[model samples]
Target: MNPVIPRLARLFLIAFAGVVALIVVVQIVWINPGKRCEEAGNWWDWRGRACARPVLISDITGRVIDTPEARAAAKDHAASQKAAASKAAPEAVKP
Candidate 1:
């Protein structure tokens, strides 16, 4: 009865399981929108989003960078918002 090989295999399986569990917990707790409903106005707003089980989940890392197209879109969006804001406010009252 070779007990050593069996014990080593068991240990490896346990460590691998722990790592998997840790990753699952991180994704659920941090990145999953369903878990972060407190930051919203209504729960239904999350309906079509990733919380509806397994879509292309974004990175959990806080260092998420915009893709090239996304970056361009964001830049355009910000510029539009800035222009709107400037137009909405009267210029500095000539103080």
Candidate 2:
């Protein structure tokens, strides 16, 4: 039985265990920046150091409601309101 061989094997095992523990710790505690940005959705712009949601250029001018779909909706809403108003109005009575 060689005592030196057993000692060397024990040292190797200890070093391996230390490395594995370090790797596990890093995996558990590390926060991935890219993952958070991706989860935020397509509106997020992750170009800079911090993750942020950029406002559209139209948003600044309060024109974000000017999409084709919105315009159509506005027209439909106006038509309905006009019809409602007219319905509530009294018609002329012919005596």
Candidate 3:
């Protein structure tokens, strides 16, 4: 029986186990939480390790879109932008 062969085999097994443990820890601590946050319709703040509401936007307009009225306005603004884009697309395709 060769002693050197057994020692090398043991070292390889230890290194492989360490790598697997590291992967499991990362999945539990970081990956899973971020996925759950997004699935719940919230933003995952990686630096803060917390979930937050997403910021609403209405094209290039700088108005705050937080209230019910503002949200309705944002929805209208988005529809108008979509209509404008569709109208412009046909003009650009003319030969």
Candidate 4:
């Protein structure tokens, strides 16, 4: 019955428990969300911890799926919104 051996064994058990707890936390917090996101066919933003739909560009035959006209319309709409915001910003700054 060596006292030093028991102390070393206790330290090893504590270290082992800490490692297991850390692994469980990592699996729950970091790994599971990314796995779920992939299974749902969405892009995972790791830094933001959010899932986003991927943009489809074209089909296998080179036919464009995301049409140019649709893009232009979106651009025009964005420009209009930006202009409106800018106009409101000046009014908001007035005393």
Give per-residue lDDT, candidate 2, residue 49: 36
TM-score of each: 0.36, 0.37, 0.56, 0.52
Per-residue lDDT over 1-95 for candidate 4, one digit per residue giving the tens place of the 0 to 100 score:
98999999999999999999999988887789989998999988887878888764444457653788987987798799999999999999999
C-alpha RMSD values across all candidates:
17.9, 19.6, 8.7, 10.6
- Provide the overall lDDT of each model, using Cα atoms, as 2-decimal numbers: 0.68, 0.71, 0.89, 0.86
Report how far residue 71 has shifted in candidate 3, in Å: 6.2
- State the lDDT at 22 in candidate 2: 92
Local error of candidate 4 at residue 50 (angstroms): 2.4
Model 2 Cα lDDT, one tens digit per residue, 1-95 = 98999999999999999999998865544435546665775333344436567666567877656589987997799799999888767563333
Instruction: Please give, for residues 7-73, the per-residue lDDT of candidate 1 as tens digits.
Output: 9999999999999999998676555655565345334234354433223234444554468988688
Candidate 1 segments whose C-alpha is farther than 4 A from its true place: 34-95
Q: lDDT ranking from best to worst?
A: 3, 4, 2, 1
Q: Please write out the lDDT profile of model 3 over residues 1-95, one tens digit for every residue.
A: 98999999999999999999999998988889999999999999887789898665544468656699977987898899999999999999998
Best by TM-score: 3
Better of 1 and 3 by lDDT: 3
lDDT of 4: 0.86
